[model samples]
Target: MTDPTGVTITERHEQDGIVMEILEWSRLGGMTDPAGLPLLALMRTAELPVRQLRLTLTDAAVVLEAGALQAWHGRIEVENTIPAGRLLRRMVGSALSGERLFRPRYSGTGVVLTEPLLQCLLPVGLQDETVIVDQGLFLACSGGIEVGAAVQRTGSALLFGGEGLVQTRLSGTGFAVLQSPVPDSELIKVTLKKGETMAVDGPFAVLRSGSVRFSVGKSAKTWFGTAVSGEGLMQILEGPGDVWLSPLQPVYDGFAALARTLGPDATEAAESGRRR
Candidate 1:
């Protein structure tokens, strides 16, 4: 598909990187709950080098476009029982925007854009020897990563294994895009309070928020294993894959569930109902 500017947008997924043009058809008020509102609808109308993007929807669309530091296009997939709303909230958090910039999250798979964003207040990168900790599961990536902190191990293997949390103090100013066990955009940034510990899935799960003191801890109970704590901002995300939002899976499953519950002709019915 092509946009009014003649930019051809197509859907695809590759191990490398892809560029495309995206046209958002709606705006979401800064509402945490993403239900009872219209879905964020768009078609792959065009593909371009995507030198720069402009979000025309209401609220802070333009801010998001400008604030976005990096953008990459690719395919994504998810298969889990997580709620769609929770997953989408995590993606919006990934963009470091409180506004509703994405739709509900779901399981399945598809293509989408993956981005790494930072808060305007923090430095562009982590300080030398600064440790970034992962409190949930270990993520494996082939990309070379600057070691921020020395690696450490805990007594309980489950609490510190690849399925648990990993911690590393920062050594210098740089960023590491560690792979996630789940496809999501939310990167939680939190400060650790004295004696405070946070258990979460990964560092990418909490993209960019204010900093506090934090450390990795174990599950409070059986199911509720790890979580992040402290008085600062902490991000949470959900979707497909291990890292980044699996566009195909989340978007496809979200809409599919909506369609099934509302009926196959829901989108059309929505238009008709709006007209009435």
Candidate 2:
């Protein structure tokens, strides 16, 4: 299906009473450089597409991150139901966890569209359980789910785990939409039986079942061993549940940092030459 602005639905995901469509634009407008058009077209062809979320709600409500709603149509009522007594607590939690300060709820039968995003959107279903997610990953969720904050189990973990002191926690039964650093295909889900454990050198494990216990530990038994192995502290999770890891997250992070550092200066030089 195509939106009124000519964006087309490129993909659809439906499960457990949730229906979401990914809308894509064929080409971007308002480019500063005509010469970059070929490169942008090639990127689109390579599936680095500009995308948005189109959610269809039928007699249900969804909680969304503040300022996420781009457009909506039909019988929808939007509200922020956070209690006055808990407002300060919620604000402090949001400040520490990197989550939005206010989450608005939209109810009734209608279509809700979200702002376009370059990151991948991952829809996760929970069945009367809880999941601990990395900071800033939450996008939206069914209203039945409870969204809160969780802290590291230990001080060392809080200091060295690289996942921040507080993370987003989603509990109860419903679907959650998360902004992922990598596509679903690149995500690795590891299910562990009781007493099992997993460890990684970075904060690549984005989501884990609430039953899983998280901590930080040395990669080797001793300092000498760690130096020889060239690995230091590692993020450790012991579980009777699941953990989702994005192994390629570091690569993407590195390139993003490079772009941020170089993009503005390069653009300024080009514009200066044009003026000359």
Candidate 3:
């Protein structure tokens, strides 16, 4: 049968249990390693977009891209497969979850957020706090996150020096690590899907909801302006890799350089434009 996105779904028998809903892509993240292919390949075979990917078991001799999966895509050996029960037995003894796979799926909210615009949580099972956010970062929470005047407070479990802690506020909350984008620095692109609009400082802004209006001004407190339009859409942001949140030193250095280069020119141009 076809799923919500018109992709077909079906079930098939494999080495163990059943491979349900393989996707149509014939590949996992462009990987061709026979020994380390994701089982999602089965879902791809069935023609789905892998809205969500997760590992049911780790250390079960399931290999994905030849990694240990201490993090994301990791695997064991196909030639020497271990039973799921054995895998779980090890985890139960070690007091850890054996499932260590990543699942990437479309957001039911029709939105997708990149690392710069999204926040990650640690002690994740215990804390539901928002740990970090860039000044004009985009967030594609299936259920929209708090923002604008309505945003009162947010929390996060920040990582520093290989440890985690609670951060109640964004500023002065200590260093929060952020994943850097691919390209270092230059121009970034933020694409707005249909019915989506955004309102933020132009240089740093990514995708905005289509329902919002974009304007330019210099009101320190209310620096940007906005208005509702329709069902808001997702924002796609692309820019320098350094846009990520790093330790205060690098962040401050970047900000300082920007201000130094722009401060005088900005003031002069503003004055020139006014006189014209």
TM-score of 2: 0.84
Error of 3 at 27 (Å): 20
TM-score of each: 0.27, 0.84, 0.17
What is the C-alpha local distance difference test score of each model?
0.31, 0.83, 0.27
Error of 3 at 49 (Å): 24
Prediction 1 TM-score vs. true: 0.27
How much is the lDDT of residue 122 in candidate 3?
10
Ordering by TM-score: 2, 1, 3
Clashes of 1: 60
Cand. 3 TM to true fold: 0.17
State the lDDT of candidate 1 residue by residue for 133-199, as single tens digits.
4432212111112322222243443343342333432233333233233333333334444444444
Name the lDDT of candidate 2. Answer: 0.83
